[model samples]
Target: MSDGTAERTNEARGRRWRGRVGLSIQSKLLIMLLAVSLASSVIVGTIGFLNGRQSLHDSAIDQLITIRSMRAAEITTALDAVKRDASLHSRNLSAQALSTSINEGFAELQQEEPEPEDRAALETYYSDVFIPELEGRTGDSYGDEAFIPDSVAGQHLQAHFTTQNQDFDADYDTLLDDNDPGDGSSYAAASEQYGDYFSRLVREAGYEDALLMNLDGDIVFSAYKGVELGSNLMSGPYRETALASAYAEAIATNSVSTVVLTDFERWIPSLNVPTMWVISPVGNDSRITGAMAFQVSIDTINALTTGDEGWKEQGLGDTGEVYLVGRDDLMRSSSRILIEDPEVYEKRAVNGGIAPSIVKRAVEVDGTVLLQPVDTQAVEDAQAGESGTTTGRDYLGGDSVTAYAPLEVEGLDWVIIARIDSAEAFAPVSEFTRTVLLSLLGILLGVSLLSLLLAQVFTRPVHRLVGAVHRVAAGDLDVQVPQGSRDEFGDLGHAFNDMASSLRIKQELIDEQQVENEKLLHTLMPESVAAKYKKGDEAISEAHENVSVVFAELIGFDDYARGLSPEQEISHLNTLMRGFDEAAEKAGVEKVRTLRGGYLASSGLVVPRVDNVRRSVDFARNLLGVVERFNAQNGTSIGLRAGVDSGTVTSGLVARTTLAYDLWGDAVNLAYRVRSVTGDPGVYVSQTVYDRTREIFTYSEAGTVEAHGGTETVWKVA
Candidate 1:
């Protein structure tokens, strides 16, 4: 073809291509919106779903942890109460006098020979009864007691044993034979006096009984006259019980040592429920003589662990619960399942191969969980002294979310486990995600329909300006509106191009100005406080649990400025203040604000940290160095007095007409007060700060200063 013909044909093809492109862009606008909107909706939906699920899981775990903590505290308080009562009684003067008199009387009774008829009764009890029992228990140590069957019977007494959870009769005749504390008139008097106090112990102290034990772990006086009063836990049938362990632990501990708490066990005979013992050494100033053991009530424990409507009130959801587990793999509190439905729980236990003894109390006791065995990660790890959370099989053989921690009682190998069935725990999360997804789908469909209606209606008004509008949309903004249509469409095209250019310029200016303004605002206050202020926050305060605060006061600043020009003094003070600011910045500290001739700064206020105390100390010490340098270079007579304290503080902007950011609390006030005690010229730190820095920084205790309504110890930072 000729050149002219070919050029004409190419121009026609280009025109057709532009016409098709413009038509497609306007007609399929809804499809474009659908694709972009659906893409954005899906991304947002996925992120929100993940966050919601994780948040639910985290919140559940946190609630469980709090419940476990509360239960542990209640149990610890009960144990401490027992310890306190036992320790007080162990030091009782009347009790001590009675104990001494009983020992003396028992010694005297042993010296005298037994009466003929009493000896005859004791011999029959020993030879015919006690000796015959010994053949059955060949290795039993109590049966091998010296002064038994071979000699004349001294006296007969009753006692109980719990070596294997069975009752052993304490029928030894010590007075008729060799040397057990014999019954006498003086002994009876002392016993009578103690028995009166024993009645007081039971009635007033809320204990099951009160027994005064001798140094050899033998009960000397009993409030209830039980069989255990005369029984020796060391060699008697109760040798394998919690009492034996408690006595041994108390004996190992010194007289001034803290009380010992034994693990849970069934104190048979007199007590049938699971019992824990709190033991404290009984003595005067000389030595640890013996121990007084007190029984901890299981009812009080069950009240706390299963309180709040059996864990539901504790945020454990439907199948949630909190209970204690011991190292012996037994429950210290009742199972909610068994308490709620004993027969069903028993059936479940039997199916799971659990012994009948565990759920037996479920029927007898309405809510007691004692003596029931459990096997789960919460029990295993917590008993091993580990604190953790996990999703796994629970003791009742269901998937569960659990948090576990060891208890705080001494000598007790027990752990607290808080749990909820996983299905119930995550049901809310699943339901929320499903709801969100369904809502998003409906929104997509609705918006898609709206977009199509909009596309068809909106395209008609702009079809006359399509070619020009397409050119503008494709970034050819210099295209002019084809006039003769002096209408809104014409005006809209002109307005669109003009407004787009103006917006572009404004956004660029905003980007540049925001960066510079943010820096200035951050310099005026802290970055965190500035952000809150910019967001129109009226009251701004945050509690920081671990922060280090520094207060440096420039002593004699008024005197030094007296002889200088106003400008000169301002320049001089600025130099010193600037140096202090630089040092704080270098050491990663935040300069809070300046006071009259003083500077304030902090570490870990914006973000918490463990090393905030160390950071503050380094900054405070460097601040001292800055003052030292200033004095040497300028011949200034100014001295340094600075203080640091590490603890909780509330930091925020106090927008009182003129906005000023500051920190307040006991920690801050203490830091300011401690500055006065550092008149000798160095950084002085409070005990809290010193504690955090002692491992790395050398310090000397500078006694204490009256601050925070009390005397707080101060240390000189060397």
Candidate 2:
């Protein structure tokens, strides 16, 4: 045949071969197996991740709901207490008689107009002190004419108690103690006679202030002698405020059992700090005369919502808080961020679309009540009387998991919300997602490798090699393929065995390195502390309130060490230190660290104990035993001088590069000082330690030593 014909024939033959071998059975099977494995892994991992995420989200919402319910109940209980107190005070005979007397006296005094000097003093207070302070807080300029009282009695009372009191401007609350303003007016006379009664009531009941308003809404008496003492609630500068609204509601009810609670608002008479009042009509069942008001303390409300500033202890984590919002979408309780870090709050508030002026006023007043706007979806839903949990933007415009419910407080449009930042709330879910994705990737990689290996080793002669490959893939690195065949398969088996050996060696090295790293980490700190460090918390610190500390100095050890060689000295020191550590561990004391010739240990640093001082003294006695044993064994005249103190101490990791756990505070310092006292070699304890452990262990009074503030009495443990 010719060359052209031969080329055409070869091309046709090559095309036929390509058509027949396009996808081999092995290749097809491998592809199908890999597809199945990949689909299975995706399905399983996706389902698991979704389930875990939903569970975490649900848990976060449920936690917030629980906190909201708790805060709501507490607020309701507080309001109920206020209502009870108001009812009790309204029914008291003294309150009724004083209300009648102050009203009659004020009406009679109004018949005789006040002098020009007294009126001028009252006008000066409104223009200079009250108006300036109110403007400073509310950021609104006011005219003195609006606040100036029209009644002579009002002017006279203001002149006597408000403008004349020296400490009124500095601390208006102090006026509660100034019963007699020396004005000799009937208001002052009434205060002198019934001042003790009202003072006792406010002090014992924890009311910020008390006011008696007549049937005409004229405030006749004030327990704290504030600017509100003479102001008229029905037709005064404060008539448009919540205080007047609540008073009107109470007076209109005409029932002593009815108590109206007003939501927090800026009351100028109180210098515009957030104030709420509980109003109840003061009357008998037959006739209603007037209404009485009890000023609810802002601190009391803040303490309830903020959990006394112990948010973490109350289970509201770092970014979680419970707060109240009014119908106007303004916060009725203090903001957590405002309480924790006001600068951060200002920055975040401005960034979150809140006006800088609002944040400025909030910071200036040192409060968030009726200042920080919380016009969030949660607040809106809660104000609409709905109770549920949802994830949405918080007041700071950060995504949050929030649970909200309308408060059951009568005469108030308020809702309670518990919330935490979404970043913190869903952190575990995010971690789980990352872990699932990585695990799915690992699964796909393993399945692909397994399918390729299975497809490659299907022949009878390569069965032994296939089994060996499978074993190695299954993490059994000890497997060896048979080399009986003298063909290429045998060479392949030899290579496979070598690869397995190399993998085993590498894995062994990796495990050894991991073990060494763990050892080094644990050697630097306690196991718990090491775990925290490994988890990326670099700043590990804890304040131990009542841990007993001990500082022991090796008496005469330096002289003894000078006689020995370097190696001998190190060996002896190691032996003595080891003995001391064993004794400390046996006595339930944690060895803090070892100095050149000193040892420090503490009890209740790692764990809290009421008898820490006693345990610490016992540990000190064990050190004496340890030193005695060391001397007896080595025939040396070495002694141990130790001191112990029981009080608060701070302990944490120090040095970022080379971390070291250390304890230092008043207790630690006094313990070290007491150890080096100019006396015989023995254990000495500070007065704190002695006082705590005296009932358990007998102590002899030793000489006093100079301490931080003055002298601390030392006691020798006998």
Candidate 3:
């Protein structure tokens, strides 16, 4: 191949490579749109997920709170019922019948030393006659001694015995034998009758067991076991708890006391089951004689809380469980076994089967206890005697939302804790979130694909238009873009073609005008100055007082021009002043003019309508910024000195054939003198300007100076 042809081919390949390297406007736009869409999708999806999770968690907490409140209400109702029944039984027992039975039965027992056969007969006779008579009416068996019976006489006795032992023996003998029946028997029977009535009422009122204990702590009678009728309750833990609770109730002016029985047995698989006791005093003449206690089975509580009905079915899901705990933190009753750890249960059984710490903590921090999912601190704030709910990690490492409510039973400090596994509680939300995320991802993917396709479709016309414009710019005016459907891009294509045609026609005239303007501007001012004036920044008319202005003129410019032609002189001055103009501009100062072979420059508040004085000061400081830059860029010997003065100046437009606005006042004149008198070719400013800006700049006083205006204090700025 010929060398000329080979070079041409290489140049063509280079141009093609450059064209490929540059991206089309359409491609850039498509990329930006995709980036924005993806960012928006991610933000929206994250927000949706967070909002959904919060909503579900809040709902679970609310449900748990409601359940706990209901449990407290039920327990309170049961206790109140027991109290009412015990009070009624105490009030209904007649004092007269008690005295009469004791008196007459004692008299009859004293009249005979009864045989075993007689004793059996008397017991039968008393059961059939006196007991029936006493049970029939409120006052019929209440005569002084008429109601007591004897088996030998086969009749009722009518007498009174005064001795304590004789009276007790007569009462007991009359009720148990035909003769010599002790008053104790009659009193015992009466007590038994009253106790049986009391127990029956409590049982009918829904309690599983009931007991009546005297002030001395002796169990007089119990519904569950009549065998322990005469046993002293003071030795037992159950009775001790009851006594303490009763005393507390009395001091606190409360009528009921509730406590939990935490001892576990082989019968109970879980150590959490607790028995609740409600104790109320049996009173006569405003003095408490004894206390009547109602005992409810833990199983009954479980049944009530986890009934076959919709109690758990309502809002609580399948895995949700409700239970009661004593103030001592022992589980009274629960629908499910809460103690999941076998080791813990074993330890509890070995340690008296009571969770003392749990009870204390519950009372101290009356909120949900979660052991799994994650360890959380106890909710101690809930024990303020108000029902409250909280959520935390449960044992087994799962999220749980639980509610706690204080139960006001007579002798027991108990609370109901209703808990639901967070997973089960918000299963619906989890499913929904999962479904939504999947759906959104799919939708986003589909949208992205569709956007890509749409981008391709729309970019085709834009790409073609770009190619046509490039061809025209490369001098291929014959190139034409195919017209697609009438759209914005179609109009753009037509506009581009018209613009190219117009540019081709006016290229010569425009180039000639540009060349002439450049030459004329260069002759009138330095290149930097001409550029600034072209950009409409002719004079530093926006200059404020306390700003520095600098002016420099060649000392013998006229003499230098004497031997040169007009063009040579103009060119030399332009070359010399151009460096200064560039230096001032780089220093962030406005070069106002370079007229009649002189230069004028000022810095600080030079921009018209500037609102910030500090910015103006910053600009003045930065004016020195350009001087150093200029010296570094060009190894020049020339230097500039500036004078700054802090004072007011008049700023307005001046009309010549061409309009000009400039700063004119004593401050500007003084600034000029300060710059001219400077011994060194650096910056100089009046004392007023120095004072205002000294904190931010290093400077030295140039003492006082006499200028075109008047003598003023001046300082040099570095």
Candidate 4:
């Protein structure tokens, strides 16, 4: 085979293949509809499912936070209550001892006489012996100072010292006189009497531990076992400047002061370890003599977070566990199921110690004692002070939910953390979501199958109408669609058949009419131009340059129309414009605009095919030819005017719906003004228009006239 024959054979083969692979219109439409429906269903279902899951998760976390917060508050309240009871008991014990000492000193002073020297001597003895003895009996010490006995000891003691104006002087005299040999024997006797009173108060008040400390921060008395008298704490490592300052602050304000666990050594090795100290001042003769301190254990605090007594029966599942975590991010206590290690069961004295690794993970992971998975984002939020629940994987690789809350204890700043397995936390929600999705999927499948069956039943008759349309498009208008029922599809089938039958009968008539219309349009414009315009292309105007634009108007058309009937005026104007249309057609004008009495038309050398000044002049001259012809044909008194100018004018269809193409810029505007300024009924042309078209038309200078807004020279076409 030759090269040309081989190419033709290949082209034919390609065309056959394309035809075989192309989809039918109905098949394409069906596929598109199904795709849209499936995508919409999936998008909506997925969104709904995700929203439901998130809502459920948020609700669970909110409940967990509330429980943790309440637990922390309860723990703080209990600790405060213990401290208050201990404080009241210590204060009452010290008050009784002080009262007894004052009474004895007053009695001794009343038994002595008044004398200056004897009073001085008595005051010295009181300061050296009586006061020191009283303070020592209370487990407090007075500093050493020598005494000198004076003459008439008892007489001067009462007479001068008793009557002294100074309060300290009088107190000295009272101390010397009131040191009855019986009272100075031992404070044990006074303590025994007051001990019973304080014991009853402590029992009623429910104090766990209380201690009275002297001015030097020594323990004068203690209700707790093993803490002895004269246990100096002033120079202890735990009793630093900060502690002393805090103690002094309590005394100065006369209010309770608290100290949190500072170091591990200070903690007692016991199952229930105290973590806080509450201190208050003990007074004697309106002076701060010592301080009363109380130790409050935080074991109940840990229990509140991790206790499972009520929770286990609540059916939170076997995977769930609650535990307490301290500020060091260690577990302080654990729920029974989680407390497998000996360290956890032993209740190691962790009062002032760092939390262990397990507890630390619980606190750091979710800030809750209960171990559970948490949302990663929520965990990060809690780290920034939000104090909320989070879900994530646990050390055992199980899903877990965890919650954390800041415990603002009166003395201890710590965090409480709780966590439970996520599978357990969300078991109920998971079960619900699974059940709903399964049921929905089943219903969707059943409904889809039912819908497919119904669609096949209803589309049977419409299929015949669809066949007829396909046959018509394939050049078989004689085809008829079958009608089986009175439903919409059946009615559509009948309508299609009737339409095909009518088209068959009118086919010849339509062909003849279309041919005649095509010929008429070609007579009015070039066949190519008319065809392009009919197809809605403004290519001629769009590609044009240097076009001569023309404007025409009937000077009194509005008044003329007002004087005549609407029908008569329209008829007369149409008859008058017939010549202008013919003239423009002859001149190859691409477009025209008829606005009531005003007419706008443009053409030129400027259009796609022509680009010469002479062609523009020829086009304008033809317009003048049509105006003269119309005047001759009418022979009536009606006058006509036209104005023409040549310049760059951009022309194109301004809107898609309207097939009208318009000319713009100074040339079009100047042309309009030329027609406007014409004194009488005659064609006028601007200097630019005249210069371009003078050789083609007879014209004379119209002279310079101020055209509406400015002056410009124009010429008349006569």
Candidate 5:
């Protein structure tokens, strides 16, 4: 045959084969199954990822809140401890005796009258550091001699000794020699021993320095610096400053027990750092000899805020830390890495997008890190006395989750902030999502291949069974599918028929159970409240007009119950309360509840009535009558103390797992408070209740009664 005839014959053969079927139901079923499985996997995997991320984020916030609270508490406790120890030292007997000796020794040195350079140095410090501090300028650099580089204040005193050692050892010896040791009590340490005693105290106390201030505010002795002797904070350049306030508070008080603490300030010349002082009186009963002021150490605070092992040891992760910020938004403590290792810290600072000022301070290049701004949202809320967690930009300009709270210090507006990088907090969740997605993709591929092999056997029977299910789903449960096909799917249709029949009967039973549940709910709460709950309302409340509220307490019941077991005690209380409930129902009043204190009941709330006041009073009296009969029967002395008040009240169901029917307003509060008036066993009615039910119940004057709001005239019901 020719080529053209061969091509025509092959095309005809292909058409004949296609005519038998275009796409078989088996192949269609396979593709559809694969598509559905892949779609379901994608949807479920996405949901799991989102939910897991949220859970992890919430956990991070909770952890940060707990960490911040612990850090703040530690700071308060540590500072208070140090302050107490220093204050005690100032009142020591040896310290007081030494103060007198030091003052006298200085006075005698004045009589010696030499050392012009020593006089000049002290006078210069007074003018440079003290005056500038009073004017409120930065005090650190102002003292020309105070910040003479690589030296403390002691260097200025070396000039007076004519010694090149640049310290006060020689001058200290001269002062001790000049001192007239009248009692010979032996404070020879003031001379030869010099700063040995003060130095030991500073080292033990962990203070930056210690100063013995004479009544005139002269720096008579110092552990680190003693250059400002004869300079008075009261009438000199340091007047009107925090140290002056501490002095005035200590010396002006009559008690030798006086110890005053000053807030933080910049100590300008000697040490260019924030300073606090604890000044305590050193005196006998007649007069204060002098005062000992110790400079508070800031290193203790830095250590506490930064944690025991620099944040990580406290479960604060790589980016997590707790630090302090003042009201002015400046850092109160040094950064963790900054204090530990500055070179490494600077690299991190740059990578973290930390502020320029903070980087400068962290490396000690500019010393501005202590004053770096912390303007995050958590800090702002904390300054307003609110404690909570939030997600926002941190001081390092990174996305972070933060917990912040105000430190409970007496005179400081500092906030403690605990935070972690969001990327670090949510990394595990992201990894989980990636794993889930990969797993879903693998399962989808496997299922698609398996479905192709199995579809031929499943399609025809499944199609017939699907129609039967659709009818059942549409509420046509009586539709009988053909179970004629001899296969597992055909058997499935028969089981489905049985399931539908059982479901219809079960549904009828559920309807009946629902009605019973409704009835049960009405028994616990007011019917109106139950109705709202049935309508899917989470909370129910309303204002009622002219409701009479009765509050009654069982006196001596709690103390009496000490004689019984836990179960028996509860049983006894329930028996008495059940009697009160019966009395309320008989009088047409509604019993709200009986809790720890007493039973609170009301009238004209669930349903209004013009005689609610009358019903309330009758209910109170009947409850007491029930109590009396019980006392006589059981040989007990339980007494009923009741109060009746009629006015507008707010009633509602407290939305909890166990619902509480309650009332509030002046009427309810007054009724409860009046129960505490006296030990009588009668119902006490307010003036409003008296006017409404006076004719029905004979009443006697209960007189002006003291209640919660104020005293008001009440009456006794007979």
Candidate 6:
């Protein structure tokens, strides 16, 4: 062709290519329709999801608030009734006469010391029964002298009531009528006179115990006649108890109308179970002789706070509950979890940051009052006299919606809290979100299919050209367009064919080099990370707050491989490594790297998981199983040892030219140190890992090892 003719032809081809570059009218309409449709679906779905979530949250908060208010009112009413009963009994003529007579009787008994046998029996009872039971319940060690009564009268009463009777544990009232050991003594005479009346009053009024203490702080009279009877609250072993505090307050007030209330505490006389007291002056205002106290019933308090164990009936859902917390940050009521599922309660309480000793005490007492700690935000806010609702972590370390308020009981620093798990509260919103997503997805699929069909029908001649362009855009440079018509469409198709043919040759060469680079990159880093490097991300690094690291090594592989050839050694090592990789994948662990004789793996590195520690431990155990299988099949005597640690770790590409991805942190270093410790070949874990998984797996103390310039405790899984 002539130069002019060739130039004209090239210019025509360029014009055609430019014209095709702009989207067709049908394609433009389709794109606009899809964009609008998707935008509408997303906007509507988001609005609905947000509104539903807010509505559910408000409902949950309202329910919790209602429960909190109701329980607080009930507790206030119950406490007021208890105060009224104490006041009524204190003002009674018979009670005042009994108090005066009991004080005189106890003073008379103090003149004669108890027999040596009686003293020995009292000491034995306290050491073998009372102190041991108290120590077991409180997880505290105590000597016999810690609880032995110093006063002669107190010793005689305790020995006669508790040592002579073995059924007191079942019923303290049983000792009320048994006064044989002290037939002619003044203490026995005083008890014989008013013991039946007080016991009857306790049974009828639903009181745990009734007490009469003189202004001198001497507990001269007890309805049930336990160790507290005849004991001095002023200078005796029970001087520091809530009962003592109530007695002191009543004596200080020295008024007939005053009713002193003290919060619950572990009472040694009651075998360390939770006990409270309400005290009143026991004589006329002119000359008060003593104080009368009623030991408050824990069952009544628990019934009010726990809704009489009818939590679900009171609109509290499956995991919802109302509880009380004292100023000491310990519970004043029973824990619902401890009532429904003791094992789960123990696990949740320990894992939720409560001390194991506290949980053990709660279990031993068969109650949570004055034992289970509830030092949560709700408790703190309520103790500060704030009444409101909040969404945060509950005492069990689970997300929950809570309502808190201060309880209005006289002389008691207590608060009420109502809470329910967030999962149960927001379940409806979660369901609605899923429904909206599925609906939007269906709409998107339907709209895309319909728009594509309409576009194909309207632009039938451009269909083959459009398909070829889509294929080329999708990395298929070998695509070619057919030219069956002699028009602009045919000319465009022919031009497109030539361009694709030329691009295909260059793309093939580029792909060959790209594949080799990707292979080398992927071998060094994780696939997801290599993709970032391929996209030109030079500084690749991440800080994981809760990743679990595992260090696994072959125990006898070096000795076994000494007699083998290099080829066989490499093959065997490759087999072992491949097996480890498979086990790690199955256990949700990521292989970080392999050293001369060890393999390092991590969980919660690439993907965060709440149970990463558990997965790492599982992976370590599986590595040992892999080796055992290999030994069984190949007749090899090699063993596997593994150590795990869970904590913060930083992972990144280490080198510029020779990209090496590596992990470094306390967790990694500790894991290596634990694995290298001198011990038998087994799976061992750091203290953190052991704490997180101790309930799930059986373990024994593997002792401590030096790591990171400190001693780290370790445990071995059995």
Error of 6 at 359 (Å): 3.1
lDDT of 2 at 99: 80
lDDT, candidate 5, at 716: 84
Model 2 TM-score on a 0 to 1 scale = 0.59
Clash count of each predicted structure:
11, 0, 45, 41, 3, 0
Model 6 residue 409 CA deviation (Å) reads 1.5
Using all chains and alpha carbons, the TM-scores for the candidates as numbered come to 0.48, 0.59, 0.40, 0.38, 0.50, 0.66
Local accuracy of candidate 5 as per-residue lDDT tens digits, 1-718 = 9966974785565446545655655457757876878687867767776777678767777777888888888988977776677667776776876788777766555455355555466456445544454335332234434322111222323333222213233433343233222323133236434445566677777777777877766666655443333455676546667888878878788567776766566564233467778887777667778888888856666668776555777888776777888888878776665655776666666666666555754465323235656778888999999998888887756688888888987656788888888878777777777877787877777787777677566666667777778888898866766555434454465567568778788889999999999889877766887778678677787777789999998887888788889998888888888888899889999888787648999998877888999999999989888888888766688888899998888776775566777789989988976666666778888888988888899988866776556778788887
**Candidate that beats the other on TM-score, 1 or 4, i.e. the better one:** 1
> What tens digits encode model 1's per-residue C-alpha lDDT throughout 1-718?
9966974785565445444443344437657776877786878678776777789768767777787787778878866777777777776766666567655554454455655655455445444555455445432333323322221211422311111112234322111122223344566656555546656666677665555566766665555444354566777657788788778767777673547666667654343456767666667657755666666666667766777355666676667877887777878877777767787777777666677655555555554445566788678888788998989977767788888999887666778888888888778787877888787877778777877786576556576677766776786645655423334444465555455556567768989999998899877665777888889888987787888899999988899999999999999899999999899889999888987699998888875666888989899889888988999777687888888998888888786468887899878988987877746778899987877779999998777888757788999987
Tens digits of per-residue lDDT, candidate 3, 187-294, equal: 345544443454445446766456555555554444443222333455532334433455335324323232222221211101122345555555544455555655
- Stronger candidate by TM-score (3 vs 5): 5
lDDT for 170 (candidate 1): 37
Lowest lDDT 10-residue stretch of candidate 1: 171-180
- In terms of lDDT, the poorest run of 10 residues in model 5 is 147-156
- Please report the TM-score between candidate 6 and the true structure: 0.66
- Model 2 has an lDDT value of 0.82
What would the C-alpha RMSD of candidate 6 be, to one decimal place?
14.5
- For TM-score, candidate 1 versus 5, the one ahead is 5
How far residue 126's Cα lies from its native spot in candidate 6, in Å, is 2.8
Pick by TM-score: 2 or 4, better one: 2
lDDT of all the models against the reference?
Answer: 0.69, 0.82, 0.51, 0.53, 0.70, 0.82
- Top candidate on lDDT is 2
lDDT of 3: 0.51
Best candidate, TM-score: 6
Candidates sorted by lDDT, descending order? Answer: 2, 6, 5, 1, 4, 3
Clashing pairs in 5: 139-268, 140-268, 361-369
